[model samples]
Target chain A: MRSFVERHTFWAIVILLAAVLFLWMIFAVWPEWLIDTLGRKKTFVNTLLNGVTLGGLYFLVASGFTLIFGLMRNVNLAHGSMYLLGAYIGYEVADRTGSWFFGLAIAFIAVAISGILLQYLVFRRMAGDDLRQTLVTIGISIIAADAMLAIWTGTTYQFSPPDWLFGAADLPIISVIRSSGDAVYIKYPIYRLAVLLVAVAVGVALWVFLNRTRIGMMIRAGVNDRDMLAASGVNVQMVFVLVFAIGAGLAGFAGVIGGTALSVAPGEDIRYLLASLVVVIVGGLGSITGAAIGALIIGLAEQFGLAYFPTYGVVLTFLIMVVVLAVRPQGLMGGR
Target chain B: MNSSRLFSGSFSLRELHPATIVTVVFLIAYPSFASNFFILQIGAYSLILGTIALSLMMLAGYGGMVSLAQLTVAGLAAYLMAILGDNSMGVMGLGWPWWLTVIVSVLGAALFSTFIGAVSVRTEGIYTIMITLAVAVAFFYFVRQNYVLFNGFTGFAGVEPPTLFGVYWRDPVPFYYLTLTVAAGFFFAVYYCARSTFGLGLQAIRDNPRRMRALGFNITLHRIVAYFFAGVIAGFAGVLLVWFNGRVSPGTIGVDVAIDILVIAVVGGMRHPIGPFIGAIAFVLLENFAIDLIDRERFNMVIGTAFLLVVLFSPDGLLGLWNRFRDRFRFRGNALLGAERVNKDDPASTGSLEKS
Candidate 1:
């Protein structure tokens, strides 16, 4: 136990403790007080639930960024704009077809195509050059954001799930006032649960793909030694294009999920992009596990900070980034 | 070892003697002849952005650290100015004299940037970008959420320039000269700094950090100084920006502005001091007039396309294109000198035009 604690002390242990303190504050020590402060236990439950789902969305977007950064030293500043493009496309598709799954499928493929185009057209020429590539991506993002604004206007768009997941799910637990016996069941949105489940399923799939497959091995090898990988007859360029497509596709997919949960607007793209950056930095670049760990901390901190402090919510998030950066510059789980 | 290497790195290898003279004459005479719209809206605005972008170029070109928080440092100055000086918004303006406010704001910006630099210089390449970006975004949200400090989204306005020597500084002609003077002063500061021991050493450190460290150079200390100096320049521009707009707000220093600053620097060509000003002129003109020509909402699309094409075609920027166009009219002997200098400064210099 001591050894295990020591192993995860800085990374997993810190996150675990944060999550526990939140739970203890809400669930154990001050449930009645929270109910009093918030006016209802349902609101508290919803807030906590929102944090988890938000974290899941962050995990989905950040994993793709980590994967691409790990394999190639390229920084895609356009990732968020691509995500916005996906969400906008998904919103249109789902609105037209009235089918949720079809929208997700189309948005995923379409965004993957866009990502590939970006690689073949822009990033391919600037191979191994970080600054120029970053600047190019920033320009792409700016153009993409502008294009979306032209088409979608400035209004926010929210997605509705298919019939099976359209409504809220009522749980067995109820919040009751100690004096009046007034009670209410905590009802959670079914779509948020779906988002979480989808995120987890994708997480497992990615782990398997990275750990147990041939291309995954090549990717790991590519990350470690690109020159040697190319010398060994592995097509490094092909792998880069592949990873870029997959990373962008994941962001697009998450965009659909996040757009559904929080609604899509003109500015949400940068917000999510910044969120992904914080997650990647906190999780350590190029580590999927680190991405997940980083996402949870950011998501919880953001939502929790908003609930408690309101005004200082973003500050809390920034403080976490600074602390993590100072404590472990390479990130908690990042080894290489 | 030529003293003229100061104006621009290899990209705009034109000697400063001719170019500086030409640019200065044009600038000084611009307000006297150009219409108010041209002077105040386009020319002055370009110079302001150009100054800020030049600060970014200093770090990126010489130090190899591309900071996204330049706008934030500049905004810090404007915010301090709004808080300290007389303002229409009856909020935090302490009603200090203009001279004291400007001094304090500029110094405050330097101190703020130094602290941020200490934290960020620990990382390199993409990590440095991420950390500085985080700091910029954090400052954006900090001002937006903390309403009492910055008046939230509405932002304090009516931050007017003080009248001195019976001259209204906010008048379009006077403002143009004011901005021009500051921008020109800092442009030369960057020029002279490039030729100094610190600037040359920074470039050497950028090319080979370990070798410089082994030879007893303090890499961190140098990087931090670069950030401080850049911040001071940006702060000067920010004060100008606030006076130009006659207000201070969260919108001015947001993440988009930070990225726009990067676009300006890169599109101008980070290799030279004049590149940023050139890029800034193009950007301001496009932003102001492009909306009339194209769909207003689609203006950013044009900018993005331009930025991409510039990066792909001439990574050194428009100045690079000018260099190519002018090289045909040049004597061949200087070209040989350029090649020899490249070999001396960076022997393994990839024959990439981007580097040259």
Candidate 2:
């Protein structure tokens, strides 16, 4: 019994707390139904939608960060650069070809290739060395940012999404909550809905990929003990390259999505980079579920802050971070 | 010497070599020989930056914590100075006596750093880095948004150095001398403390916290104290930094500046007490000249390249390079003098940890 606790205490406590929080969240959303039933303007709907969308994007970026850091123990500070570069590449492709699909495809491919080469050329040597890897990645990011500035200029650029996913639609589920003949449907944009859906799909797909496949098993094993895995006759180096590329590709994809939803500019890389850090910290490093959980909490907290307290919206995020640190330095998930 | 052996290692705390005296004399006379613009802008500014970087150096070298929040702490000091002392912005300024304000700002910043140290001390390696990064990022955003207290983006201005002892401290010569004196005092203090038991214990923890803890030292308390002392140094520099610029703003403590402090410390070499000072001078020179030499937009890229090169080529920085040259000649002298028998167990070899 004691051995059981010593082993399972980390996950047991985390999942239990998560279940409780999830139930509480469901109850908290019940207020929206009440507000909708009264036929009043559903103010919480927009905030909820935006928060989920931002969280999805944050998850997309941070999962990649988790992948690289978890499997190889490398802290790639330049992951944010990949995100912004993806936005720029996607923007350029969409601009010339008038095809959002092509833009995303090309951006994903380009960033993935860059990630592979970077792993081989730079991060490979500093694989286990955190300090050098951080410094080197920071250098890469600075150079990338400057080069981006030279080409993209410092001005903000908005991505044009394909027309089908661009407009607003009635909140279809709210029909059950509305009173008879007083139907005032909360209209949220389709792009944001699509963003949230895509993010969910990506999360589910990654979960399956990490848990179900041969490569996935190796990545989990590598994260647990890379040297031992390598000694067992697996080409852990190839697995490392694969994970790094995938993470970079995910960041790029998120960049395109983020650029379309909001706007991309010079400082967005650092902003998202910092956001990813917050996500990983709150979620626990090197875990997919942790990133997902962290992204949602951070996303929801930020949106609510922005909605209710417009001026102090930014402070609320940090306040939550401080609370998390002071309360549980290990993070919500208690992952290794 | 035997009585003090446990605290001071093999070196005497009051030992002052001939080179120290020459360096001191040269520094004291630098403003007289140089132009006012050079003395005030370059010399004094570098010392202020150097001192802040030195705080970071102490943590990284002695405490085994590489925190990115030092600049934020310094910015906190600078902002506090504006609020406590006289600021023309008029909204939050207390218009108190200068000395009182200085004391409060330094202590307040130190206290703030102790809190940061508390939050960060539990995590090891990259976790600590991430947590500190989070704090610094949050601080930047909080200051930027709180307009009533921080005056929003533009921040406060017209912060003046005190007219202490009936002499204006902001005059070029006086300001240069003041910053120099502060830099030197802090440098000697760090050198002295490094030889003290507390400093050695901190270094012991840096190398192996488990072993240090086994010996019954409270690691967390020591780290927090180190951070507190570092905060006081950085906060004092922050006060000087505000006076030098005559303003305080969110930009002063931005993420870029925080990272820049890390770069300055790393490039100068983290091992020695004098490394941050050297790094600051190099950084100031780079900042002043990099734009002209490279595409103006790519100034950061140039710094990035230099930093990467240093990390890759010289882990110990410029001081390491100096040691290499000195070691080559010293090896020859040792061979001629029949002192080649010195090995890793020798006290002299403790300083040379860069050997591959």
Highest TM-score, which number?
Answer: 1
lDDT of 2 by residue, A222-298 (tens): 88888899999999889988998999999999999999999989889988998899998888888889899999989
Candidate 2, which segments miss by more than 4 Å at Cα?
Answer: A1-41, A173-181, B1-15, B332-356
lDDT tens digits by residue: candidate 1, B1-356: 34464334432446657866887799899988899999999989999999999998888888888889999999999999999998898989999999999999998998888878888777777788888888898889889987777888889899999999999998999999999999999997887787677787777777778888999888998889999999899999989999999998889998888988888988887777887898999999899989788887677788889988887777667866665555534736577565445435542122231221
lDDT for B328 in candidate 1 is: 37
For all candidates in order, the CA lDDT equals: 0.84, 0.84
DockQ, Cα level, model 2: 0.56
Model 1 ranges with Cα > 4 A deviation: A6-26, A29-44, A172-177, A180-184, B1-16, B331-356
lDDT of 2 at A106: 90
Interface RMSD against the true structure, candidate 2: 2.1
